[model samples]
Target: MTTEMGNPRSRDIVLIILSNSIQRLTFLPVYHHATVVVMCCLWLQTKQSLFPIALVTNASVHVIMYGYYLLCVMGLLPKWKRLVTDCQIVQFVISFVVSVLMLYYNFTGFGCSGILGRCFNAVFNASLLTLFVNFHSEDYAKKKQG
Candidate 1:
């Protein structure tokens, strides 16, 4: 049943443990690091098959974001700054959908793990979505108007 549902329990545990340790060593603001650590711990407790999907989506978006910043640093500012924001917004929307699905599956089936963590994740994503939308409106919308 676990294998059929895509929840490779042991592997997910190891991955979350490794990621948590690495995050501890990395230089992030204290609050951000703490938040990530908590999230990682929560994920460690989750048996949800969709956890990896969320992780991959978030990581992919960050890779693109950092790549965009790298281009700007190299004096090659891509004209696709708006695209980066668009991607972030899209990622959040996808995350919300995934969270909803997780909830549905949790109630309808054998239940998912790490639901608490998923709630925290949804709130965090919501805040980021709000901030990014405001940034887009203030930066891009103004340009279009004036």
Candidate 2:
């Protein structure tokens, strides 16, 4: 009887770990965008202005990507996963676009430079937190198995 219970408990642990992994991967895109936004904000602090063209491009891409994530969380966007879906792909796209746009905006000096510490961040935190939390615990397992 003890052996039977032990195996079952181990199975539960494995399922929980797998679920958490899925949760982390699913949110990778948002996390990547957030980190980039944080980096951009840090860069802007010393510059005090986002007028340079390169700055404009990078800032714009980040804003767009952030917007995508924000909308997705609010169910404004489609569920991220599809037949070919992987959240990391979205993240990679955001990173690449941000880099390319950074250079472009830097050249043109046209961009929305400040989106951090504003509605985006607050909504980002709230939505992502809630999104992941819902994927956790007994509720998630039930959903997963069903």
Candidate 3:
């Protein structure tokens, strides 16, 4: 809670980016990337097996990027947690922990690479979800309502 003096959380920056999405220019990249990926998948289905798989794999990358932004733009994720906790720091800690574990896994290769990598991405990327849950479960939201 002790926000030294002038700095803010990365979630604030992310929220700013989300807010800007209301403008037409800012919204187009998300839409364009999403649509292109989808179209690539559909096109890949025609005659090539590898193309389909590759398309799906690449498209999933965009799915998270654009989808997360879209959710932020829609006000689906709450915004108050940054007032109490440093989201950027928390996310960085989480990422660091996961990265250490992933390095261990890299040496061990103890399980499926695909699944492990995907789990890493999804877990680290749940900052917005965590923010939403924190906002809803905290007293601030209620206080603001009154």
Best model number under lDDT: 1
lDDT of 2 by residue, 1-146 (tens): 13422332234334446657545433434453444455445545644233254345444545554556568658796443231122323443443455445446645876444433222333443454444444443444675699
Q: Write the per-residue lDDT of candidate 1 for residues 1-146, one digit (tens) a residue.
A: 23312433233334446757544332222333345555556666765456788778877877887789689768997999888889978997888777777777778985677788777777766766676677778879888999
Lowest-lDDT window of 10 residues in candidate 1? 1-10
Q: Rank the candidates by TM-score, best first.
A: 1, 3, 2
Instruction: Provide the overall lDDT of each model, using Cα atoms, as 2-decimal numbers.
Output: 0.67, 0.44, 0.43
Better of 1 and 3 by lDDT: 1
lDDT of 3 by residue, 1-146 (tens): 12312222223334556767445433323433333343333433433223334335444544454455577668887544343234433443554455455556656866324444434343533543454346445645677788
Model 3: worst 10 consecutive residues (lDDT sum): 1-10
- Which candidate has the top score in TM-score? 1
Compared with the true structure, model 1 gives a TM-score of 0.67
Which scores higher on lDDT, 1 or 2? 1
Q: Could you tell me how far off, in angstroms, the CA of residue 30 lies in candidate 1 after the best superposition?
A: 9.9
TM-score of 2: 0.24
Q: Give the clashing pairs for model 3.
A: none
